[model samples]
Target: MDQTDREILGYSRYVVLAAAFSAMFIISPFEYAWSSMSGHIGAIYGWSPEQVALMFTTFIIFQSVGMLPGGMLRDKYGPRWTTAIAGLFSGVGILSIALGPSYPLVLVLWSVGSFFTGFIYNNAVTTGNKWFADKRGVMTGLIAGAFSWGSLPFIFPIRAIPASAPPETFFTVVYIMAAIIGGVSIVAALLMKDPPSGWKPTGWVPKTKAIARPSEHNYTVSEALKTGQMWVLIVSFVLVSSAGLAGMSNMVAYSNSFHFTATAATAAAGGIALANGFGKLTLGTLSQRLGVENTMILSYIVSGLFLFLTIYAGMNRSEWLFVCAAILAIFFWASLFSLFPIAIGHYFGEAAAGGNYGVLYAIAKGSGGLYGGILSTMLITQHGFPFAITIAGVMAIVAGLILIPLKYSPPIWKDEEAAAQLNARAAVGRR
Candidate 1:
């Protein structure tokens, strides 16, 4: 390509990335912000804690299940239309909740919204994989990090809602959320496009024996499913993600149980949110240097340690220690957001990133959600928070051990350069 073409590619790639970041940020309230709304909504509706938690489980189940078809659509038709559709679903879903007549209706509407948001999430992550193949870790981290911190803007406002506020205030906040999520998502979706096959950034060069280049060959979803490594990765994903989800889904409630004041508890939750964002940003970049798997191992182990410390903080009634430990645990969880996508692209090839990774991620998240949301709630109610935290910590440590086997596995696909190098060497031997 000439200078003009390079300029166009450069401009389009960066702009699309920016748009993906913005979309992830706007759409974040659909998931992460819900925790802030849960207690108030429960109080207003005269629902029990378990009932409120069931709504979260409903949202998570649909959100994860929807990613399969949503990812297929993005791979086939591209992100533009799919993301626009997601924006519509998100707007309508949030609005319906604001005007919902009953609790069941609210749950259904939220689930529908969660389902569509998967489109936005998958499209954004896949875009980073497609555009920044050379810088996959950093770009994926930025997208995930945006998602990690996106709830910050809404956290305070949502938390401020009194147990018995006028319904108008709640409706207004949701309405504003709908508009921002819908408007920004649609705009960003329109701006995105996939780079042409075999495209690379200007002035970039591939290794003579490059391995796992998507340009040479990509794994189809079916083909990727047949790999043992994929299964291992998925199971590991489920275990670690479940731990993170459990902590995040119950962080506020856990703080309250420790006798922290409402203000302090909410602040602790915010601290968790910040830790999530910083973990993605820092660890994502760190993965580039340390390797994604190595970084994941470190993240999981450290998180497990801090999670155990959280139990100690609760026993000692040290709010600061509790908050710090909670933040570190959450930080490790957030790192997975970056690591998994990057690993998927490397293992499965970027050509089928949207579909293949989508399938794996959906299963991982669906199972993890169940473990964290309803299961954690059950454990907390019956065995108390300490037992739940112990389970989560053990799962995190187990996840790290599961990934240790991957160190010996080679890339599933060989790039053109690597194939050619092998062929040339064989010819020399024959001569």
Candidate 2:
């Protein structure tokens, strides 16, 4: 706001963004690499696909659970300390997972790692909004898009495997991966914090006070839940986002089901990562111009159609078609990430965006954390990818429709009220 504050913001934002991007780089790879270890893990641990899938299910459960508290911590204490504590916890968990002596230990370690990883995204989004108040949508999208950083490390591992090798070896590799990935992520986490406006980039501007005005009237997390629109966001995203997560969590396996080798399937999954990152950046920025609600609707429509296309591609067993369909699928899928945060900023203002978005994210992603793994495996086992992907696709269409009601609705807080509210919440608690 002031010249000194602007300069500080201009310089410090890069460190903040890097911290977020790095976290994504470490944790995201696991999504793409999961299937590669499936067969090997199954052999060594002597588990079934249902069991292995449940491993992911557990990760989701913990991650969803962690988001609310993580966001609240970030909201309460600010970005730096929250991420630092989380990183410490995440590093320990991942290390434990990598060194697991038994299957039960692996589950415990992985769950802990997943919960800590949840801390990074919450801080990253919160920090990004703090960094670029003027360009909230675009900036948020860019940061959200960087979630593909998760996919970056996975390409190599997914490609290196020999089909005949046991799944248990894959587990060992993941364990090693857990140590390496977790280590780097912990280091990255050290550099993160919320920057003052105009601190890092010269031209960077905070989102207009109008677009992201904090409520002068602060709402407790409980108070926020009492609003009418909160349920809309929760129910809508839970239905639609579950489909996206289902696809993301299962992309590699979904491709394998179509007859591709694990390596090839992994590569295709990376493409989804690429699309996800790009979609977040593109759609997030686009929301700035088209409006968050409109952009979200479009993302839903596009993502749904592409998901259905995967079914068609599967039936034909056309690698190119499948690849194309999957690539397109990422575009819409990634947009969901950006839009959710941006919309929260729009509806709630930045005052409680961290906590507000955290709750919605908890519901949407948490449910996916459970529902997606089950749905993906069940659908494929019973009706197959066509049936599975089609169902998800329909949910996306409905998810897009969820935004229709927001068009006529105004933000829960106006500008003058927002400033007062945030100042109050930022103040102190009564004994």
Candidate 3:
């Protein structure tokens, strides 16, 4: 246990962990359940598929871009007020959608809500990065996994909504969803907090020989941006994230493109939600033993392979194989959320984790959203699902290969004087 955390908060850090998990869980339906609900939304509004895809793209843009300021604010001011306010807005946004506004208004409301979702997401994941440095992989993975599987309850319910269901039926579900998201976020906000700046678990020493060990120096967001490693990580993130987001957003449509039964498509979607969550939990802990870089390379490549297999299965119209392949693809792809944050903490140091990771996520994931949503939609419209899926899978493979040559080393300072100053800064951060 962290003695300082206990003294400061009068409870175990797991309390904070629980809060983070709950906050992350509430935001899951926005992303993961979208595919299930999107058709219904389009049905009610008479909107084209491209228009609906643009709504998702808009949400992704706001969510990813909003993380930067959210993270910066949390790093300076703690998470309480920011999380609370964001949660309130997010919940209200969902409730507004239930009122059956115009398509433009729906986009406006969703984008605004999505912006707050990013804030909560940044606050939740970075809580793990800041508090559980001793067990970052597992702890962070658990919290991040909540964001995936938490959609299960919502997904199943949303999937159950028949295509012929009226707007009132959709309204009821959204109302309930809004209440859960908003109410839980406020509760989480009250519980969420950062550990004292230098706190670590009592009696636990960091292993210098650990493969994913923390860096000796803490780099500010700008300093981290200067490193070649950061750029490589961004590119890799863009590729893998693009693939994962595309798969997630289009899973149901992809399943149906091959003329599979509604039951099979629903099962595939549920399988993805479950597999993605569990994969993050499993691979995250596995990374602790195997090393982050190796795990990433293996996971990304395997994910790509499974994505290709998914295409083959879909083409052959094998319902079971399609579900299994899609599940495997998402299972391995989902680890990106857990592994990347761990990498950011290890490579840049935990002191500025929120800000540093926010920059990476905003750039990579925002672009990923564009590719996965708008561009993929274009490709699917013109060339078909197979081409777009193939492109995404190839990119995933390339993303893994890009990490093969990345080895962590101390940053190269211009001179001994600069090195000393950097080390001094890092020492101060530790204190």
Top-TM-score candidate index: 3
Mark the regions of model 3 whose C-alpha exceeds 4 Å error after superposition: 1-3, 211-214, 408-431
Count of clashes, each model: 0, 33, 0
- Where is model 2 poorest over a 10-residue stretch in terms of lDDT? 193-202
Q: Which candidate wins on lDDT?
A: 3
Pick out the ten consecutive residues of candidate 3 with the lowest summed lDDT.
408-417
Q: What TM-score should be assigned to candidate 2?
A: 0.85
The segments of candidate 2 whose C-alpha lies over 4 angstroms from its true place after superposition are 1-11, 95-101, 164-176, 180-182, 195-220, 261-264, 414-431
Give the candidate order by descending TM-score. Answer: 3, 1, 2
Q: Could you tell me which residue pairs clash in candidate 1?
A: none
lDDT for each residue of candidate 1 in 1-431, tens digit (9 for 90 to 100):
52332365556578888988987888776667767877767766677888878877776777788878888888888889999889889777777667555877888788898898888888888876788877777889889888868888888888887866787888788889889888998899878877764456777664422223433467889988887878988998898988988888888888889998787678777887788878887888787777777888899988888899999998999988888888888888789888888888877777788888789879998899898888899899999999999999999999888898776673455465588789999999999
Per-model TM against the reference: 0.92, 0.85, 0.94
Off by over 4 Å in 1: 2-10, 206-216, 414-431
394-423 in candidate 3: lDDT tens per residue? Answer: 999999999987754434434544877989
Go through the candidates in order and give each one's C-alpha lDDT: 0.81, 0.70, 0.86
